[model samples]
Target: MNLQTKIPLKPNTYNQIDYHSKVLLLGSCFSENIGEKFEYFKFQKLQNPFGILFHPLAIESLITNAINEKEYTKDDIFFHNEQWHCYDSHSKFSNASEIELLQNLNNQIRSTHQFLKEASNVIITLGTAWAYRFIETDEFVANCHKIPQKRFSKELLSVEQITESLEAIMSLVKSINPKVAFIFTVSPVRHIKDGFVDNTQSKSHLIAAIHQVIEPRNHNYYFPSYEIMMDELRDYRFYKEDMLHPNAIAVNYIWERFVQVWISEETKTTMKSVDEIQKGLSHRPFNSQSDAHQTFVKQLEEKKHLLQSNLPHIIF
Candidate 1:
């Protein structure tokens, strides 16, 4: 008898990810988790340059600004908590110096514009449909930056709104890079702060909107990441200490499933070698000056050189 219900996942027959493919991952912290895997495998990838954007509107805003090469001006940012912050970006971009923040934001946007033009696969992981609209600016904010809750009104994006945002993202990116494929997935992390019922509603809107935009002819597809978490790994054991985020075991399991579907079979052997090198590099010897340790270090360097020779873009 089957122990658990598994989402039926099949490897993509075309547009599979290889070492050569430049992957651009945007959106939620869950996307960061997957991006970490890509990094470990030394795949050519760029993730969350502006930081983890949760909603489609935030992602849409980011793509729009990046495509247009929006330069951050003094009016675009505010001083709060003794640091300069932008309403459209994660707090990680906040800087004590206004000039630094502006410079960083503009530079990242410029680079993102160039990277998006060359990216082969764009993976977007939608975290939530719920968003905060800053009443002062009368615009949706990606993060509230610890501002008083009363200063912003929480709004749940309707399916139509999310669909439009997603369509705009695809259109904007495709205008510059016509052949790029979009792999959209809903994040599995539960937003318990939104309340159990509200979280479900938010996820429902995201799912509905994503389906409306994903089509074979459009070169867009959906992966059942949320379904796999809720169904295949339904137990609380899969959750972390907070009882919300997926634990390492769950993350690894989901990653394996993703690899099964997305990673190219031709590149798996290279991934194995990369994994071996990674493990070797991380191995700590008891005696640093020992001949054995020196030999190991030299061998590790040789492996790195060989791998780098084959994939010039990959760096340890």
Candidate 2:
């Protein structure tokens, strides 16, 4: 008997990711998790240039700004708690110097714009439908940045709103890169702070909206990450101690599933080679001067050089 119900994932027959594929991942902390995998595997990827954007509208705003080459001005940012922060970006982009912050934001936009034009796959992981609208600016902020809660009004984006935002994202990105495939997934991280029931409602909205917009025939795909977490690995064992985010095991399991769907079969052997090199680099030799250790190091170096010769973009 099957121990667990698995989400049926089909192998991607076309547009499979390879070492040469340029991937851009945006939205959610989960995007960062998957981006870390891509980084470890040394795939050509750029992830969350503006930082972790959770909602569809926030991601839509980011793409719009990037595609239009929006310039961040003083009015777009505010000095709060002794640091400069943009309402549209995560706190990671906030800086002590206003000029520095603006420079970083604009530079990221320029770089993301250029990358989007050449990206083979654009993966977006929407975290929530809930967003905070700064009442003062009448704008939805990607992150509250620990400002007083009273200053902002919380709102839940309806399915129609999210669908529109998704459509806008696709339209804007496709205008520049017509052939880029879009893969959208709902982040599995539970927002328990929103209250358990409210969190479910928020995820429901995101799921509904994503289904409304995704067209597989158009190369727009939806990966069942949330479903896999809730169904296949439906236990607290898959969660971190906080019981909100997926632990390393769950992340790895989801990643393995993702690889089966998106990564090309021909790249698997290369990935194994890269994995061996990565493991070797991390291995700490108890006897640094021993002949055995020295021989292991030499073998590792040879493997690295061989891999790099074919995929020069991969760097240890």
Candidate 3:
């Protein structure tokens, strides 16, 4: 069955599927927002194997810790700040103990390999083209400064490199789950230091790279998260206090936009109507009644409010 509503691409309808399916989100912090909304929608199989930030290194560490049966604690961590940890593109572990936490990392990848073997849909949120590599093994280390930048190298990636990385990752995903479909999105949260002009360039490169890889493939695809953030929530007011990420309202708008693409029209209409009714009830003006008449009057008011308004207007 077509999971999405078949509406015209121009002015797509805001409808998503009623029934939830298992989903795994791996990528940047934006994926966290997507995951939270899925929870709101009560998606049946939402999973975040890589946790927040969706950094490959964090996922590797998480898997390692799970395999070794050792806990991943701060003692082993070089960075404890939630901001850096959420999407650990530029963080690291303090010592060998942190590395020890990753004993199960490989095992978990093997398990992910197994699970994706049968997954129907998988979403990957690509955050950046910059990754840190260890000096010795040429492996991408989770963090650089936790050890030394000198011990590792900063490899700024091109769009081609990102496309290759996603392709490699997707290839692994497909090997484990042959029938799985893939969705790729570039994160909207800005890395301010990348320089305003440079940051914009990087995003363009990333998006272009992702499209080049996925556009020709029948099974792979892309989502316009970058466009929505840049075009829909262009104003600074839509951003959080930190001036980087989108606030709740902006995130909601993005979720709604996504629903237009992934959800069914019928379900969208029903949900919209329900939301309207609820809003109307909440907006009913203050009322008064005698103590003796309180319960009866309140009940009548609620019923009247329900019957009188088919659509509720938001006070704002």
Candidate 4:
């Protein structure tokens, strides 16, 4: 008997990610999780230049800004709680000095602009449909930056709104990079703080909107990350202690499924070699001067050099 119900995933015939593919991952904390895997494999990838953007609107804004080469100025940033923050970005971009914050934001936009133009695959993971709009400026924020609760009004983005945002993102990205393949996935992290019922509603809107835009024939695809979490790994054992996020085991399982679908078969051997090197690098020697330990270190170095020689972009 089958212990778990598997989600059927078809291998992508076109736009399969290989060692040479330059990938750009945006949106959600889950994107970071998958991005971390890409990093470990030493794939050419750039993830969340503006940090983890959760909603479709925020992601749309990021794409629009990057494609247009938006420059951040003093007016774009505001001083709050003794720190300078941009409403369009995550708190990670905030800085103690306003000039530094603007410089960082503009630099990121320029970098992302270049990356998008050359990216082979663009993976977007939408986290929620819920968003907060700052009442003073009537603008949706990627993050609140811990300002007073009364300063903003929370709103749930309708499916129609999300659909439009997704379309806009597609149009903008395609305009700049016609050859880039798009992969959209809804993040599996539950927003329990939004209330359990509200969380369900938020996810439902995101799913509906994503399906409205994803066209496999056009190289725009959707991966069933949320479904896999809810079905295949349907147990609290797969969750962290908070019972909201997937733990390492669940993440690894999902990542394996992702690899089967998106990663190229030609890169499998190289991936295994990279994995071995990663593990060997993390290994601790029982005896620093032992012959066995020295031999192991030497072998690890050889593997590293071999990989780096082929994929010079890959750095340990």
Candidate 5:
């Protein structure tokens, strides 16, 4: 008897990702997990250049700003907890020097602009519909930068608002790169801090908004990452000790499913070669000067050279 319920999944008949595909992944920490898989398989990809943006409006702002090449100034950032922080970006961009912070932000803008123009597949993972509005500025902030609660008001985006935000993202991206494909997925990491019921509502809104824009005939698609986590891997065992994010095993399961549906068959063979090279490169020998170890290192270098010869964009 079948013990598990699986979502019906099939390989994409067109626009499948290969080694040559320049994939740009945005939004949420879960997007990093999938990005790691792409890095492991030596695929051409850029992940979260503005850091992990959790909501569609933040992503929409990023797309619009990047396309317009918005330069960050001192006014765009604030000093918080003795560090400079930008409300439009994750705290990872925070720095002790305000000048450095603004420079980094503007640099990312130019780089994101370039990568986005060349990207073939843009995979966006939405984490939550809940957002924080900085009351003083009357604008939604992507991150609160650990500021006190009273400084910002919390709000949940309606499905219609999210749909409009997503549409704006698509439209802006298409204006620059008409052939780019979009794969939208709701992140499986439950936002428990928002309360259990609120988390469900937030995810529901994100998924509903995604469906409103995804059309296979237009090269816009949705991947059921959240559903697979909720149903197929429906157990506390699949989550980390925090009991929220998917554990590595669960991420691997979801990744394998993604590969089956989106990765090209020819790319799978290249991935195997890349995986073997990766494993070999990471191998540590007990004896550093041994002839056997030296031979192994040489052989590994040769393997890297061969792979790089074909895929010059890849580097170990």
Candidate 6:
């Protein structure tokens, strides 16, 4: 669990599995990306009714709120096209009745908790400790601007508070489903707005809290997503346009590193073949909009020829 040692660390990332795995992803938006990658890798994804966020409190709030009601919909919980549910194309918040919306939210939470109970391995990608909280209730919210920033103020969680919250979450998870194993990871994406020193301190505190909580326990463990990105892939070139989330190439690198830890050698070979094909095609030059389709065709033709020799069979 400790980044230094304890959880038999992988050199790059965890290994890819030959057969699809039934995984439930919790934690931040990074978990959503991981889930997307797992699907891309052909792993069977278990649906989570709750949306992913940087904090568990947000997830818990959604679920708790939903459970108290009866109706449900994906829009009641998930983020779509970078916009939160109510904030998306439809401002359902303004149109939907409170009783109906309340019920939908409750059902979403109940479904999510049920999903967590059945998940074989729960991957939790914690984003940051800094969050905006509602001033009246002292409850932390996901996006403060949804209700106006004046309603909520920013709060920085102490190391002890984070530890306590995580411990409580662990208890909840175990209480509902004793068989599931938890895999913790600190998201490497920087929170440039959290103040450089404070953000750094927050991450350091999280890493320490994770190790302290899980090291003594045999079943719970952590994966070094933060270390892999921060230490191994230090170059800023790996980042995307936002410079917050890792670029596609960087994500591939991180996923590869994760595969090294969990996937078998045979599975690794298959993944490598697939990845090579993708990398080879993604680099083709397209000078203008007109060239895009033609370039794609050329890439496909090149791929076809490349595959003709020493062909790699995808059994699954």
Q: Specify the highest-lDDT model's number.
A: 2
| Candidate closer to the true structure by lDDT (higher is better), 2 or 4 | 2
Task: Summarize candidate 1's per-residue lDDT along 1-316 as a digit string, tens digits.
Answer: 9999888888987778999899999999999999999999999888998899999999999999999989889999999999999988899999999999999999999989999999999999999999999998799999989999999999999999999999999999999999999999999999989999999999999999999998967689998889999999999999999988998999899999999988888799999999999999889889999999999999999988998898888788
Which segments of model 2 are wrong by more than 4 Å? none
Question: Could you tell me every candidate's TM-score relative to the true structure?
Answer: 0.98, 0.98, 0.65, 0.98, 0.98, 0.69
Clashes of 1: 0
Error of 1 at 248 (Å): 0.8
Q: What is candidate 3's local distance difference test score?
A: 0.59
Model 5 RMSD in Å is 1.0
Please report, as a residue range, the 10-residue window in candidate 5 with the lowest summed lDDT.
Answer: 39-48
Q: Write one digit per residue (lDDT tens) for candidate 3, span 1-316.
A: 8533332333322222343335667767898888886655445344555444433344434333333344333433343432223122333312244344344333444455555544666777767666677777677754454455687776666777666666666665555566667777888988776677767777777788777777424467777887787776778988999999999988998887777677676656545544554554455445545564576557656654653364233111
For candidate 4, the 10 contiguous residues with the lowest summed lDDT are 279-288
Where's the lowest-lDDT run of ten residues in candidate 1?
Answer: 216-225
The residue-by-residue lDDT of candidate 5 on 198-259, one tens digit each, is: 99999999988999998988999999999999999999999999999999999999999999
Model 4: CA > 4 A from native: none
Instruction: Look at candidate 5 and tell me the lDDT of residue 186.
Output: 94
Q: Candidate 4, residues 1-316: lDDT per residue as tens digits?
A: 8899898887889999999899999999999999999999999999999999999899989899999999889889888899999989999998999889988999999999999999999999999999999999999999999999799999999999999998999889889899999999999999988999999999999999999999988889999999999999999999999999999999999999999999888898899999999999889877989999999999889988988999898899
Off by over 4 Å in 6: 1-8, 11-20, 59-107, 266-316
| lDDT score, candidate 3, position 270 | 46
Candidate 6 TM-score, true structure as reference: 0.69
Q: Least lDDT summed over 10 consecutive residues: which range in candidate 3?
A: 86-95
CA lDDT, every model vs. true structure: 0.94, 0.94, 0.59, 0.94, 0.93, 0.63
**CA error at residue 7 for candidate 3, angstroms:** 14
